[model samples]
Each structure stands twice: as C-alpha cells, then as structure tokens.
Target: MLLDTFGRQAVDLRVSLTDRCDLRCTYCMPEQGMTWLAKPTLLTDEEVVRLVRIAVTLLGVREVRFTGGEPLLRPGLVGILTACARLQPRPELSLTTNGIGLARTAAALRGAGLDRVNVSLDTLDPRTFQRLSRRDRHHDVLAGLTAARAAGLSPIKVNTVLMRGINDHEAPDLLAWCLERGYELRFIEQMPLDPQHGWDRSTMVTAAEILDRLSTRFTVTPEPAGRRGSAPAERWIVDGGPARVGVIASVTQPFCRACDRTRLTADGQVRNCLFATGETDLRTALREGGDDPRTDARIAELWRAAMWGKKAGGGIGDPDFHQPERPMSAIGG
Candidate 1:
C-alpha cells in the first residue's frame, strides 16, 4: 500500500474520462459552458487503462471509480470499463454520471463490467430540474434510473446537492421517493468547486439542517461512525427500517483525516486532493514511453510524490481557503 506523509493509504483512484458534460448544472458550471480540452489533449483509452493497471497492481489501489463532467459523455467509456475489469484481482468498478445519456447505455455499461452507478439528480420537479441544470432532461434521468435497476445495478446511489431555499425544502419528498424505489439517496452539501467562484457558505445547507428537516417526517438515527470507511457519505438508518440515507458533509464536517482517494484528470494530471492546486503531469511521461517497466515505475513515483504533500483537508471552511481554478466538472466530481 502507498502511504502518504500523513500515514493515509492511497487505496481509491478516481479517473476522469473527459472534462465535457452534457448538462450545465448551475452549481457546477456556468450557464454558458466553458471551453473544453482538445481531443488530442485528452488521454486515450489505452493510456487510461495503463494508468489504472499501474495503480491497481503497483500502488495498492483497490477501488477504481470513473468520473467526469459526465462520464456517460465519453465515447470510449464501455471499452475503458472492460479494460479495467480485466485487471487481476479486479478493483471495484463504479461510475458517477448525470444520467442524461444513461438510459441507453446502462445495460451495455453493466455488461462491460461496471459494478454500480451513482446518478446525480437534484430535484424530481421538472421545472426545478430544468432551472438547476439549464436543460430539460428530467424524464431522461428518470428513465435512466429505471434502466439502471433493470440492468441489475444493485444499490443504485442517487446524489443530490441541497441548496438553501432551492431544493432543500424537498428533502422529505426525495428521501421518500428513493426509499420507495430502493435506491440509496445521498444529500451533498454544496461546495466551492464552481468555475464562477460564486459559492456562498451562507446559502449552502449544512448536514445538521438536512437531518433536522428529515427527522420531521422520518425517524432518522445516525449510523455508527467508520461504517463507511474512507467513503465520503455518512450513512443513517431512515425510520428504523432497512431504508437509509447519507449526508456528505464536506463543508461543515470535513473528512480529510481518513481520505484515501486520489484523482487523475482527463488531461492526465494526478491530484492528491479534489481541491488540490498543484498537479503532477503523467501524460508527458506516458507519451514519452521508452521501456514499459521504466515508465510504470516513474508513474508510481509521481503518484507517491503527489500524495506525499496532500493537505490534511480540502479546506472548504477555512478562512484562507481558495477555490481551485478548475470547476468541479474539470476536477472529476
């Protein structure tokens, strides 16, 4: 296992297939989408698979997650998943998507060795969905969820960002809908990863607020700490039944002490933390390949060096915190 200076093991790897997304979520990007990286600049399928192989075989990474502006937008996603699944002692493969294009691809993706999925759906209201995403794909997302379940993607996770006075009022409705459908729902606190840098802490909903609202309609009991391991979401049993919900309190309760995840951008930059300001360019080294063993060794060294300096936390609530230049989409949310 690769241990950083803080004694945190790097066991989870998040690979960004592309920086382009189909939806323009207000909290993620501007209404007018930003310019995207050129096709040649993005890592090829072969390069991505090679990096994952090195991480899994060499670095002690046990879980591999595919993320992007929208992972479904990548053309070679299925092939990428197939390649990653072929690894010996296969890492747990999952994806995070906006679900706009998942209806047609969920089955194919599962067939290609995808274990599960996390779909981002903030509101069930059509008008609010359109207003938040700057697009009308609410029906598409619903269809995608149905198709995902039909494809046997067990425990499909739904990610919802609760914004004050925006979708916060619908907490009970969202939880009930997920419980009825048997999907794991997680409410995420809005962070400062937007490209426009307009994140106002006051307008962001805290985990306490989320619990207080949900407790009104359901018996919300806190799950034991560490049940989720290094995972971000903190789980809770809803109404004392099998149904449950989670709150990713990234802002108020930072989980940096147990953070074991590292990120690789679509352009091949390795980031120790999601909000990291510095990046190690692995594309240059990979493209200059000479000996396979030598290049793999160099990549491992770069990954270790990057994680060695990882800060204790994302610092979202710190007084001196500064949002990264890249938006959440670019950072592989």
Candidate 2:
C-alpha cells in the first residue's frame, strides 16, 4: 500500500476519462465554459488501463472510480470498465455521472462490471434542478436513477450538493424521497475547488447543520466501515426502508487526516491533492516506450513527491485560500 505522510494508505483512484461535460453547474463548471485539455494530453484507453494495472499491482489501489467532467461522455468508458473488472484480483469498479445519458448506458455499464453509480442531483424540483444544473433534464436524470435501479445497480448513491437558499430547504424532503426509494442520499459540502464559480464560504453549509436538520425527522446514527479514507462522507442510517445517508464535509470539516485518494486527470496527470497546485504529468512517461526502468523510476519519483506533499489536514485553516483550479467537475470530482 502507498502510505502518505499522515499514514493514510492509497487504496482508491478516481480516474477522469474526459474533461468534457454536458451541463454547466453553477458551483462547478464555469458559466461561459472553460478551456479543456488538449486531446493529445488525455490518456488513451490502453494507457488508462495500464495505469490502473500499475496502481492495483503496485500501489494497492483496491477501488477504482471513473469520473470526469462527465464520465458518460467518454466513448470508450464501458470498455475501460470491462477491462478493470477482468483484472487479476479485480478491484471494485464504479462510476460517478451527472445522469444525463445514464438511462441509455446504465445497463451496458452494469453489464460491463460496474459495481454501482453515484449520480449528482442537487434539487428535486424541476425549476431548481434546471437552475442549478443549467440543463432542463431533471426528468431525464430522475429517469436515469430509475434506470440504474432497473439495471440492478444495487445501493445507488444520489449526491446532493447543499447550497444555502438553493437546495438547503429541500434536505428533509430529499431525505424522505431517498428513504422511500431505498437509495443512499449523500449530502456534499461545497468547497472552493473552482474559484471561478464565485464560491464564498459565507454561502457554505456545515455538515453538522445538515445533520441537525435531518435529525428532526429521523434517528441519525453512524454506519460502520472497514476503513474511511479521504472521501469525507460520514455515513448514517436513516429511517424508512434500508436507505442510508452520508454527508461529505470537505469545507467545514476536511478529511485530509485520513485521505488515501489520488486523482488522475483526464489528461494523464496524477494529482496528489484535489486542491493541489502541482500535478505530475504521467503521459510523458507512457509515451517514452523504450525504457521500462526509466519510466518506472520516474513514476515512482512522482508518487513519492506527491505523498511527501500531502498534509496532516487540507483546508483546515486557510479560510481565505482560494483553490486555483476549477471545481469537482473539471477536476473529475
């Protein structure tokens, strides 16, 4: 296992298949759209599979998640997932999607050995959904969720980004809906990952506050996990059916203390920190075909540097610190 400075072992890798997305969320992708990485910089399907192989064989990467500006946009996504599933001692493979194109692809992805899905859906109301997602596919997204369930994707996770005045009031309602549907509803604390979206901490809502609100309706209690890494979502069991709820406190509470995640950008750059200022380009090593020893040495050196740069806690203090990169979508959150 690749352990960091804080002794957090790297077990999961969130890989971005593409830097392109369909909808432009208010808090994520830029309003006027942002510049994307060049196609040549992006990792090919074979290169991505190679990286995953190395990560699992060498770095103890046991869980692989395909994310993106929207992973569904990648044409070869299903093929990549199939390859991961067929790996020796295959890791748990999953994908995070906006659910725009999920209806058509859910069954195909599940057939490809995708364990499950996490769909980004902040608002249940159609108008609010369109306002937040900048798309009029609320019904389609919901249909995607239904398709996921129909495809037998067990324990489907619906991610809700709680922005104050935007979807905060709908927390209880969303909780009720998830409980009824047997879906896991996860509330994510908005971070300033992309400052271009005009993120202000003042508008941020704390996990504690969300819990306090949720507790008014259900008996909230912690759910157990073998190991909780840097994902930041403190899970809980909720009322009605077997539905669960999780709150990812990245802003008010950072999980960097136990963060074991490494992000691979669509352009083949391995990012040590989600909010990291520096990224190691892995494409160069992949292209230099002749020297295996040199390639391995370079990748290892980059990994060591990234692990060395990991902090005891990220976003613990620096209230005024603005992340230079775009938010989760652009960075494959």
Candidate 3:
C-alpha cells in the first residue's frame, strides 16, 4: 500500500492524460496566453497504462480516474483504457472531462471499460455557460451528457462550480434540472487553482450557502457523517429520498485527512497533494528503460515516498498559503 506517515493509504489514483482543454473556463484558465505542455513531454499512452498497472497490481490503488484539461481530447484514450482494463486486479476506471467530445466518444469509452464519468457543467443557461467557460458549447455539453447516459456510463455525475456573482443564483435550478434528468449533481467550492489567481474567499460561495440555495426548492438533508469516507464530496439526500446532491467544499471544508487520492500529472510527476508546491519525478525513472519488474518496483518505491511525505492538509488555511504554480488545467482535475 502507498502508506503515509499519517496512516493514510492512497488507493485512488488520478491520472492526467493531457494538459490541453477544449473549453477555457474562466475559473480554470485564461482563454489566451496559455502555454501548453510540449507533446514530447507527455507520457505515451503505453507509459500511462504501465504506470497505472504498477499502481494497481503493485501499489494498492483500486480506483483509476483519468483527468485532464479534458481527457476526451486524448487521441489514444480508448487504447489506454483497453489496456488498463486488462490489468490483473482491474481497477474501477472513470473520467473527469468538460463534456465536449463525449457525444462522439462516450460509446467507445464505455465499450472500452469506463465505468462512470464526472463531467463539469456549471450552469443550465447557455449565456451564463459561455460567459463562464469562454466558449459557446453549452448545448454541446448537454448533448454529451445524454450520449454518456445512453452509452451506459452508470450514475453519470455532473460537477458544478458555483461562483459568487456568476451563476450562484442558479443552484436550485441546476439541482432541479439534474434531478429531473437523473444526473447526480455535485457543487464544488472554487479553489485557488486558477492560473489568474483571482480567488477571493469572501466572494466565493461556501457549502452552507449552496445548501441554502438548494433548500429553496428541495428538502436537502445531510447523509450520516460516518457514511462519507475518502470521497471528496459530502453527499446530501435530496427531496427526502434516494435522489441526492453533493457539495465538494475543498476550501471551506477540507477533507485532506481522509484524502485517498494521488495525482499523476500528464508529464509524469507524482503530486501528493493538490496544493503541493513540490513534485516527485517518475517520468525520468520511467524512461530509464529496464525490465518490467524492475521498473514497476522503482515506480512503486517513488510513489510510496511521495505519499509518505504528504503534508497533513492542502495548506489553503495556513497564513503563508500560496497557490500551486501549475494551474488546475496542467495539474489535472
């Protein structure tokens, strides 16, 4: 197991397939002046599958979530998923995307062994979506979600970020829309991962405020506190029954103590924490060719060290807290 000094085991692995995105969401990155990773710097599809294999077959990882600026943009994605699905102790596979190309790729992805997906869809309004995402693909995202459902991706999750002045008022409406469509909705508190670094704590919406907004139209009740494990989202029963909603309050309610996630960037760095300022390089060791056992052992060793050195928390509450140099886009979701 990838055990840390704090007695936490990293069982969930978030793999970044690429740092390129189709939509330039204002909260994620600037629309212009973005410098993307060089193609050569990224891990090959085979390298990704191998690393994931090591994590699963060797390092005790059970869930593999492929994230990116948009993972759907990766050309070799289907092949990578196919390979990972064939691992000895096959891990539960999922993807986090902006839902741009899912209309074309959802069926292939589900057929290739993707179990589910968490797509980012902030607003139900097209104009609000364009203003927030800096793109006119609002309908495209909705269409993609429909495609994902038809493709049999179970419990297709919709991740929404409610900005203060932007689309905060649409919480109730978003929940109603999601409930009607049977799409699980999760509202996330905006973190300090944007490249522009314009995050303001006062102006940002909190989990309490989100629930308050939703309560206007839905009788939302918290699930038992003990029910939430390492999952980032704190789920709430909606409308008194099986229907539910989640709030990922990364800033206001940090779940770092129960964080089971280990992030692998598109370029092959091990990130113990999302707000970490440092990274352990696994790419160089991966490229140093050797037998599969030897390479896998080395990868496992480095991963263990990275987790062992993980900080107690994401550090957003500290007086000296500073945002990570790489934006969320480069670092993956």
Candidate 4:
C-alpha cells in the first residue's frame, strides 16, 4: 500500500478533467473568471488512464473519483470512464459534476460505467441558486439529478457548501427537500482555498453549529462510516426513514489526520494535500515519451515525492499560513 508519512493510506484519487468552469460561483471562481489551463498542459485521456492503472496496481488505490471545473465538459469523459472500468483491479469509479450540462449526458455517463454521481446543489430557491452558482442552470441541475436517479445511480449524494448569511437559513429546508427526494445530503464547511477569492473566517460556519441547529428539529443519531472508501463526513441518521446526513468539517475541524485522498490536477500535478504548497509534476515525465518501464518509474517516483509532502495536520488554523494560490475550482473542489 502507498501509505503517506501521516499513516493515511492513499486509496482514493480525485482526478480533475479540466480547469474551465461554466459557472462563476462567488466563493470558487473570481468574478472576472479563471484563466483556463492550456490544452497541452492538461493530461490527455491516454495519460490519465495510464496513471490510474499504475495508481491502482502499484499504489493500492481502490477508488477513483472524476471531478472538474465540470468533468462533463471533457468530451472524452465517457471514454475515460470506460478505460477506468477496464483497469486490472477496477476501482470504484464515480464522478462529481456541476450538472449544468448533465441533463442529456446522465444516461450516457452511467452507460459508460460510472458507478455513481454527486451533484452540487446549494439552494432550492431559484434566485438564490442563480446568485450562488452565478448561472441560471438550476433547473438543468435538478433535471440532471432526476435523470441520474432514473439511470440507476443509487444513493445519489448532493453536496451543499454552506456559507453563513448566504445559504445557512436554507439548511432545514434543504434537509427536508433532500430527504423527501431520497437524496443523501452532505453539508460542507467551506475551506479557504484562495485568499484572492475573499474568504472570511468570521463568516465561516462549523459542523457542530450545523448539527446543533439541525438537532433542534430532527433527532440525529450517529451512523457508522459503514464502508471502507467514503468521504470525510461523520454520518448521521435522521429520526425518520433511512435518510442519512453527512457533514464535512474541513475548515473548522480539519480531517488531515484521516485524509485518505490524493489529487491529480488537470495539468498532471499530483498533490498529496489540498492545502499543501508543493506538488509533483507528472506532465514532464509523460512528455518525455519514455517506454513503459521508464514511464512507470517516473510515475511511482512522483507519487513517492508527493507522499513526502503530506502533513500530520494541514495547520489551517495558522493565521499566517494562507492557502496556496489555486482556487478550489482549479483544484477540483
């Protein structure tokens, strides 16, 4: 197993397909928008597939999650999924999308071997959704979720990034709506991925606060993590039905000690930690046109180097330590 210095086994990989996003979420992308990564800088489908195979075979990776500015933006996404499904020890493949253009591609994605999906939905109010996402694709997102359900993506998860004074009031309402629709709801504490994006610690909310408010209405019982490969959300079961709620407290309560994730940027930089400064560039090795053995050596070597960058904790509380320059969108939030 490819265990990092922190004792966290690198079992799941989040692969970014592109740096270009259609929406300009207030917290994620700048109002002027983000600079797109050059086409050549992004990994080709073949390079991505090759990397995944090596990661699963050599590094004990058991799950692979495709993410992006919107992974659906990649024209070769279906082919990528098909390649992932063909890996020797095929990892549990999944994708996280904004669902802007997912309405038509939902069935195609499932047909191409995607195991499940997680859609980003912050508010049920159309106007609020538009303001938060900076796009009027809320209806498309809903349609996409509905289609994903119809296409057999079981236990569909919806990620809601809560911001105080923004969507905090929608928590109870969001909960009721999701439970009624049979969607697993995960409320995430927004992390400071970019200082330029204007993140204020005072405006941030904690997981405990979310639970405290939620419990006043519904009795929440601790639910087991249940599976080996899962996101860093302390699961809970509401009083009624099998409706499960998850809370990801990345900022207020960092999960660095238990972080089991490794991220590969669309530009082929393997990052061991989300808030880490340094990264190992895999593009250089791929561009050299080496044979299989040489290429694999470079890949493994890069993995090891990045693993050395892992910290016991992210030190997110440090007032002096600002986040790395990349925005969450560029890092596949």
Candidate 5:
C-alpha cells in the first residue's frame, strides 16, 4: 500500500490517457490559443497499461479510473482498457469523460472491460450546453448517455459543475432529469483548475446552496457515512428511494482527510494531490530503468515517497493557497 504520512493508503488510481479534449468547455480551457501537449510527451498506450498494471498487482490498488482532458478522445482507449482488465487482480475499471464520442464507443468500451462511466454534463438545455461547452453537440451527449445505459454501464454517473450565473439555476432541473433517467447525478463545486485562473470562491456555488436548491423540489436524505468509504461524493437518497444524488463539495467541504486517490498525469508524472505544485517523474524511471523486480520496487518506492510527502489537504481555504501551475486538463480529473 502507498501509505501517506497521514495513514491514508492510496487504493484508487486515476490514470490520464491524454491532455487533448474535443470540447472547449469555458471552465476547463480557453476556446482558442490553447497549447496542447506534444505527441512525444504523451505516455503510449503500453506505458499507461504498464503503470496501471504495477499499481494494481504490486501496490494493492483496487480501483483504476481513466481520466483525461477527455478520455474518450484517446484513439487507443479500448486496447488500454483491455490490457488493464487482464491484470490478475482485475481492478475495477471506470472512466471520466465528456461523453462526446461515447455514443459510438460505449458498447466497445464495455466489451473492452470498462466497468462504469462518469460523464461531464453541465446543462440539459441544448443552447446552454452549447454555450457552456462551446459545442453544438448537445443531442450527441444525450445519445451517448443513452448508449452507455444500453451498454450496461451500471450506475451511469453524471458530473455537473454549476458556475455562478452559468447553469447555476439548473440544479433542481438537472437532478430531476437524472432521477427520471436513473442516472446518479453528482454536482461538483467548481475549483481553481481553469487554465485562465478565473475561479472565484465568492462566485462559485457551494454544496449547501445545491442542497437548498434541491430541497425546494426533492426530499434529499443523506446516506449513512459508512457507505461512503473514501469516495469524494457525499451521496443522498433522492426522495427516499433507490435513485440517488450526490454533491462533491471539493472546495467548501474538502475531503483531503479521507482522500485515497493518487493521480498519474498523461506525461507519466506522479501527482500526490490535485493541487500539488510538485510532480514525481515516473516517465524517466520507466524509460531509463530496466524491467525487473529491482526496477519495479524502485518505481513503487518513488510513488511511496511522493505519497509520503503529501500535504494534509489541498489548502483551499488558506490565505496563501496557490492553485497548481498545471490546470485540471494537464493533471487529469
């Protein structure tokens, strides 16, 4: 186990496939003048699989989630999923995507061993979706969600980010749409991961605000804490039924104490936290070090050392808190 100084073992690994995305979401990156990672800097499909294989088989990682600027944009995603699924322990595999290409690839992804999916869907209104994403493919996303459901992607999770004056009013409506379709909806507080560095805590929505908005329509009940188990989302029973809703209060209610996630950038750097200013270069080790037990242990040791140095929390509320140099796209989800 990659145990941190805080005694939190990293059992969940978030591996990024690429830093390239198809959509130009307003909160994620600028519509133009965005400089993407060079092709040579990206980890090959083989390298990604190798890292995940080691994390699962050697380091006791149980769940592996593929994230990216948009994971569905990776051309070789099916092959990567297939290789990771073949590991001896067979880690639970999932993906976080924007659902642009999922309409065509959902079945293939499921067949290639993807367990479930979490898609970013900020607004249900077509024009709002286009406005938020700067893409006119709102119907494509809905089709993708439907395809994922048909492909047996159990618990199809929808990730919604409510920006101030931009889709903030859709909380109740979003939850209602999700509940009707049986998609577990999770509303996330916008963080300071935008490339433009325009995130303002004063303007961002809060979990309390979301629940208060939701309470106007649905009876939200908090699920017992025991069932949460290091998951970021604080879940709720919607109207006291099987259908559920969640609020990931990352900024307002930080979960650093219970965080079990370790992130891997597409360039093969090990990120101990989302807001980390430092990164451990596992890519150099992977390429320079030979494939052997000694090399494997050395790689694990590097990861352990990275985790050991993790700060107590993301330090969002601190007066001197600094946003990471890399935006969320570069750091994965």
Candidate 6:
C-alpha cells in the first residue's frame, strides 16, 4: 500500500479518459464550454492502461474509477476498461458519467468488466434539467439509467449536486424516486470547481440542511460511524429500512483527513486532491520510455511525492481560497 507522509493510504485512483463532455451543467462549466485539450495532447489507450497497471501492481491501488467530461464520450473506453480488468488481483472497476450516451453503451460496458456506475442527475423535472445542463437530453439521462439497471450494473449511484433556491427543495422527492427504483441517491455539496468561478458559500446548501429537509418527510438516521472508510459519501438509513441515502459534504464538512483518492487527468497528470493547484505529469515519462523498469520506478516515485504533500483538508471554506485552474469536467469529477 502507498502511504503518504500523513499516514493516509492511497487505495483509489480516478482516471479521466477524455476532457470532452456532452452537457454544460451550470455548476460544472460555463454556458459556453471552455476550450478542450487537443486530441494529440490526450493520453492514448495504451498509455492509460500502462499507468493503471503500474498503479495496481506497484502502488497497490485496489479501486479504479473512470471519470471524464463524460467517460462514455471516449471511443476506446470499453477497451480501456477491459484492459484494466485483466490486471492481476484486479481492482474494482467503476465509472462516473453524465449518462447521456449510456443508453447505447451500458451493456457493452458491463460486458467489458465495468463493475458499476455513478450517474449525474441533478433534477428529476425535465425543464429544470434543461435549464441546469443547457441541454434538452434529460430524457436521455433517464433512459441511460434504465439501460444501466437492465445491464446488471448493481447499486447504481445517482449523484445530485444540491444548489440552494434551485433543486434543493426536491431533496425528499428525489430520494423517494431513487428508493422506489433501488438506486442509491447521493447528495453532493456544491464545490468551487466551476469554470465560471461563481460558487457562493452563502447560497450553497449544506448536508445538515439536506438531512433536515429529508427528516420532515422521512426518518433520516445516520448509519453507524466508521462505516464509511475513505468513501466521500456519508451513508444514512432512510426511514428505518433497507433504503438508504448519502451526503458528500465536501464544502461544509471536509473529508480530507480520510481521503484515500488520487486522480489522473486525461492527459496523464496525477492529482493528489480535487482542489490541488499542482499535478505530476506522468505522460512525459511514458512517452520518453527507453527502460521500462526505470519508467515504472519514476511513476511510483511521482505518485508518492504527490500524495506526500496532500493538504489536511480542502480549504474551500477559507476566506481566501481560490478555485483550481481546471473545471470539474477536465479534472475528473
């Protein structure tokens, strides 16, 4: 296991397959999306697989999650996933997507050894979805979710970012909808990752406020502490039953102390934290490869050095916290 200076073990790696996405969510990017990385600058399928192999074999990473502007947008995504699954002592493979294209590719992805998925769906109302995403494909997202379930992707996670005066009022209703369909709903606190830099702490909804709203309708009880180890979402048993909901309080309540995640951008830069201002470039080392052993050693060294400097917490709540250069899509949400 790779242990940082703070004794935090890096067990999970989030890989961004592409910096391209279909939707332009208000919280993720500007109405007009920012410039995307050139295709030549993006890592090739072989390069991505090589890094994952080193991560699993040398760094002891046990979980690999593919994130993107939308991972489904990557043409060779299924092939990349299949390659990762063939690793010795294979890691748990998962993907985070907007779900617009999942309807067409869910079964193929599952067959390629993808273990499960987390789909981003902010609002159940079609009009509201369009207003937030700047796209009229809300129904496409719903269809994608249905297709994912039919493809045997168990425990589908629905990621909802709660923005006050917007979709915050639909908390209970959203949870009810997911519960009825056996989907695990996770309410994420809006972070300062938007490209427009319009995140306001004053207007952002808190996890406690979310629970209070759910309590008005359902018995929202916190699951026993320590049950969520290094996982961002805090689980809760709803209405004293098997149905559950989760809240990722990244802003109001930071989980950096227990954060065991590291991210690899589509261009092959290693990021120790979501809010990190710097990254370690592994793409250069891979492309300049002559000695495989030396390159592998350098990869391991870079990973350890990056994690060694992880901040104790994400300082978004600080008075002078500045947002990172890349938006959520490019950075791998």
lDDT of each: 0.91, 0.82, 0.93, 0.83, 0.92, 0.90
Compared with the true structure, the alpha-carbon lDDT of candidate 2 equals 0.82
lDDT tens string, model 2, 241-291? 255689998878777777778888888788877887668777777788435
Model 4 clashing-pair count? 0
lDDT agreement of model 6 with the native: 0.90
Ranking by lDDT: 3, 5, 1, 6, 4, 2
Q: Per-residue CA lDDT of candidate 6, range 249-306, in tens?
A: 9988898888899899999999988998888998988888745678888888888888
Candidate 1 residue pairs in backbone clash: none
lDDT for residue 257 in candidate 6, whole number 0-100: 88
Stretch of 10 with least lDDT, candidate 5: 289-298
lDDT minimum window of 10 residues, candidate 6:
284-293
| Deviating ranges (above 4 Å) for candidate 5 | none
Q: Model 2 Cα displacement at 265 (Å)?
A: 0.5
Tell me the lDDT of model 2 at 54.
72
In candidate 2 the C-alpha lDDT for residue 291 amounts to 50
Q: Which stretches of candidate 6 lie over 4 Å from their true place?
A: none
Q: Over the stretch 1-333, how does candidate 1's per-residue lDDT look in tens digits?
A: 667788999899999999888888889989884989888889999999999999999899999999998889888999999999999879999999998888999999999999999999999899999989999999999999999999998779999998777889999999999999989999999989999999998899999999999988999988876588887999999888678899999999988999999899999999999899889999999999746679999988888888888988888767898889888898896
Candidate 4 lDDT, tens digit per residue, 202-247? Answer: 8887898889878878888877555423468877789954778999
Q: Which tens-of-lDDT digit does each residue in 106-177 have in candidate 3?
A: 999999999999999999999999999899999999999999999999889999999888999999999989
Root-mean-square deviation of every model:
1.0, 2.3, 0.9, 1.8, 1.0, 1.1
What would the TM-scores of all predictions be? 0.98, 0.92, 0.98, 0.95, 0.98, 0.98
Candidate 2 lDDT at 99 equals 94
Poorest 10 consecutive residues of model 4 by lDDT? 222-231
